[model samples]
Target: MKALHIITGLGVGGAEQQLRLLLAHLPVDCDVVTLTNPGAVADGLIDDGVRVVHLGMTGNRDLAALPRLVKLIRAGGYDLVHTHLYRACVYGRIAARLAGVKAVVATEHSLGDSQMEGRRLSTGVRALYLASERLGRATVAVSPTVADRLQRWGVPGPRIEIVPNGIDVARFRFDPLLRERTRRRLGLPEGAYVVGGVGRLTAGKRFDVLIRALAELPREYWLLLVGGGAEESVLRRAAHDAGVTDRVLFTGERPGGGLPGADLPSLTAAMDVLCSPCAEEAFGLAVVEAMAAGLPVLYVSCPAVEDLPPSAARGARRVQGGADSFVRALLRVRAEGAGPRSVPDAAHHYCITRSAAQLMDVYTAAVSCTSLGVSSS
Candidate 1:
């Protein structure tokens, strides 16, 4: 079936990269449209021969783009319109309906109990999201935790589909030579124990907590902050203030140039341990990537990892007391020494093939209902 995927600015975030990866695995003919800046992922999509349209939305309230989006959907004659991120979900669903498209699906990639779009959760914001969500046939949650959160936010249980985020397991498999090369390229000391965190450098990610945790660790322990955001300068200053600037490394916005410049597997190979201190994570993609790389993971709160089966949860440890807890976890893992661990079978469950298959099921269900003149919701 012909499908059009819509997303808020195509920057190099998890959701944007996930869309890029999903397109390669999905069986249907799909095109992409970005509401604003078509950034890095747009370039990657173009390289992959996917048609990407930029609406040039002035801002969040740019209502004029609605008609333009509707025209595009109608002209494309798409059987399904799949939306991602918040703004796209709201506007895409509306435009799909306006264009008379019967099947519309949205993926909820980053919503949690404490925050939505890295901002404080307010009643009005929740109301706006729920209202937009109702316009779609189904909402795909990246994790079961996200599905539970959607229900708590008033989305009907049946409308929420749990589809865990996937990673390239083989790409992240541990390789001693590659790890050494990656560390050398990144200017990391051979003997130092590395603690790495990946994702946008936003306040919600609590990189500050990670910096503080690093400060408390031994001098041989180093911090590698991957991914970039507006919080870069603030985090740099915090690192300097903590007197760990020498030990802390910032790889800027783009660390590795492979795969739209994310190069997650290479960067993950360089890390001795992975940390995700964000409490409001909808699904911990980086954490899973680390596990796939055979590195131990220390997380403050991540339901995605927590929900894994015991056999698959092998190198992951959850710590509670914030920075102090992080410090202890780091030291404990260091004491245990780095050794080869098998990539969990559960990790394989999140491969892109599985994600694509689950997504196709959602798409087929939505289209089947639409064809039958029955409400999917």
Candidate 2:
């Protein structure tokens, strides 16, 4: 089937990267549209031979793009229009309906109990989301927790489909030589215990908590902060206040642009342990990548890993509370000398191939149900 995928912007975030991976595996003709700032991921998508259109939306109030997007959908003759991220889900669903597309699906990649699209929680926000969600055939949740959150936000249970986020597992396997090379490249001292955290340096990511926790750990334990956002300066200051600035290394944003850059897997391999302190994570993509790299993970609470079977999360520790809780967990892990633990089976469970197959099923089922005049909701 012909499909058109829409997203807010083709930045290097998890949702954007996930979209690129999903398109590679989807068994259908597809094109992509970015509403604004066609960033680095846009280049990667173009390299992969995917058609990407930048709508040049001025801001959230740019309603003129609606007709233009609808025209593109109609001209492309796409049978299905699947959207990712918030702005795309809202506008894409409306445009799909206006364009007379029968199958419309939206993947909720970052929704949480306290936030949506990095905005504060409010009834008006939920009302807007619920209104747009009703126009779609199905809302795909990246995890069961996200599905439950949607339900709590007033989306019907039947309308929410749980499709956990997937990763290219083999791409992230541990490589001792590569790890050593990466450590050397990053100027990390040999034999220093490395504690790593991935994702945007946003307030929601709570990277400050990780820095604080790092202060509580011994000097030999270093902190690696990956990804980038507006909170970098603040986090750096937090590390300074905690007197761990020298131990903290910020890699900024690495988009994995098929160049000689420090990619996620290599950076992941360089870490002795992966720490995710984000309390409201919809799906822990970094945590899964770390697992694929055979690194023990200490997550404050990630529904993505928590929902997995025990065997898949064999080396992961789910600690609760706040920074103090994380500090205690990190101390315990360091004391035990938590080494790389193999979890090859986790790749099977969170593989992109499986996610692609499941999504294809959702697309086919939604279209078939529409053809049969049955309500997807």
Candidate 3:
């Protein structure tokens, strides 16, 4: 089946990474095209022989991309259009209908009582979303919290399906030899306890809070943050102001580089624990990666994180969702062991492969429902 997936950007983020997996793993003949600009994740798509149309949409919902987006959808003859992120979801659904695509679906990767940014904007978007949601075939909630959020926004009835983000557990499984080699190559002391995180240095991510919490911890614990964004300067300043700048490192945006997960997984395996202190998280990709690496995670409780089993509760000493708890949890994990344990498989039924398959089902269902003139029930 031909598929067209839309997202705000192909930048280094959880949803983008998930899209990368989808493009890579889908059936060889299945056509795929992206709505956002080609990014660090594009090389993989090209390698997989998938078509990527960089709308030059930039991240701001460019109207220019809309015409191209409409033309592309019409020309590609996509059977289904699956969208991620808010702008893309709205734009994709509208464009799909305008192009007369067979089916349209959107996934809610974030959940909230209020959005992280402008309330007025969220209100306006919610209104448009309500309209398209009624017109679209299916809606996917990355977590139960997202479902509630969509329902609160009056999403075309209660048909939203919960599809938690998943990882290729086998890919992230523990590798002691790789970790030792990575540490040696990076010149890190063999016994140093490295607390790491992989995410953009954004206000919502609360990397500053992590720095604040790290200042309270003992000196042996070093923090390594992967991924970068517009606020790297602000976050670095926050760390410097907190007097913990020396303890943290930023790898900046990789655009099209590789070393671990983005830099290659060795850095992941080298981490004793991955601390995701985001005040808000939709699916907590960084946390799950840590868990997959057998590295424990310390994060404040967030709705999307509800799907994750606390490492502490599973005998890994989880924090109580605060700065102090964060420090205590960090020390607790160190004293306990380096193994954070992988997420229980049952937690995420929506593996990338399975998620794509479900979209196919949703696609077929959308066709049938549309043909029957029945709305989502």
Candidate 4:
């Protein structure tokens, strides 16, 4: 099948990485197209032999690009147009219909959990999300939480499909020697316990919360922050205010250019624990990566990760981080024999190959439904 995978920006993050993985590994019988800001993530797909289309819009609401999008889709004769994120879904769906594409699919990597904060824009997005759901041949969310979130927001239940974000563990596997070499290259201490968090430097990621939690931890523990965005300066100051500046490492905007982008896995293998203190996460991709690396995951009560460990089992350690509760969780995880008794099997759950197969099922199901003139229901 000829597939056109559209996203907002080709930056470094869970969704973008997931897209690269899917594009790189899907059967060669399938063709791929990516639409986004000209970024390293887009560059990565191109490197993998996947065709990418760069709109290079001067601003977010660049309507002029729509015609070109329609023209491209029509010319390419794509059987399916799979869009990611809000912008792509809304615009790509309309474009696909205009181009006479048969199936329009969308993947919800993250929903706008910050709706209250982005209230001014949320009203419009909610409407658009609902419309896109109706237009899409199938709607996919990377987790049950995300799919349900869409249902609560007005997307019909029949339209929602839960497909968790996946990783390529073979590509993301832990490598102690490589980890040491990476630390040395990055000028980090070889023996220090590095707690790593990789994501967009934005409000939802809650990097400030992670830094504050660090203040309550031992001085020897280092915090590694990756990626870049509007929240960079704020986080830098937050790190300083937490009195953990020396221990904080920020690697701004290094996107893995193609399939199995390289930043996190190497950095993760060097870490003692993978920490995600975000206020809300759609699928918690970082948590899965850490889990796949056999590292214990710590989060601020994310249902996706928190529920994995039974009332008493080897799962994530939940902490009400950035407050008294967070400090306690930090201390507990740091305590001898308090964290994961053994490293987890994080790889089994999130492998991209398996994820792709699962997505292919969703794709096949949706395409078959469309071919039969039926609904995803």
As for model 2, its CA RMSD to the true structure in angstroms is 1.8
Best by TM-score: 1
Candidate 2 residue lDDT tens string, 1-377: 89999999987788988898888888899999999989988888888899999998999889999999999999999989999998899999999999999699999999988887689888887788889998889999999989988888889998888887888776786788988999999999878889999988889888898888888887888999989889999999999999999999999988851222338888988898999988889989888888888888888768877787777677888888777888888788778875655765765688888999999989998888778887645
* TM-score to true structure, per model: 0.97, 0.96, 0.87, 0.90
lDDT of 4 by residue, 108-193 (tens): 87775565222333677677667766777888887777777778887888778777777666655666687778888778875677
Clashing pairs in 1: none
Please give the CA lDDT of all the candidate structures: 0.87, 0.86, 0.67, 0.71
**Which candidate number has the best lDDT?**
1
| Prediction-by-prediction clash tally | 0, 0, 8, 7
Candidate 2 segments whose C-alpha is farther than 4 A from its true place: 256-262, 338-340, 375-377
Tens-place lDDT digits, model 3, residues 64-109: 7777888988988777778887778777888888898747778877
* Pairs with backbone N, CA or C atoms under 3 Å apart (clashes), candidate 3: 259-263, 259-264, 260-263, 260-264, 261-264, 294-340, 312-317, 312-318
| Residue ranges of candidate 3 with Cα displaced over 4 Å | 28-36, 58-61, 116-121, 254-264, 302-305, 308-318, 339-351, 371-373
What are the runs in model 4 whose C-alpha is more than 4 Å off?
A: 28-36, 116-121, 256-261, 301-303, 306-315, 321-323, 337-346, 375-377
Number of the candidate with higher lDDT, 1 or 4: 1
Ranking by TM-score: 1, 2, 4, 3
- RMSD to true structure for each model, in Å: 1.5, 1.8, 3.2, 2.9
Per-residue lDDT tens digits of candidate 1, residues 162-259?
88888767777888888889899989876988899898999899999989998898898999988989999999999999999999988866533235
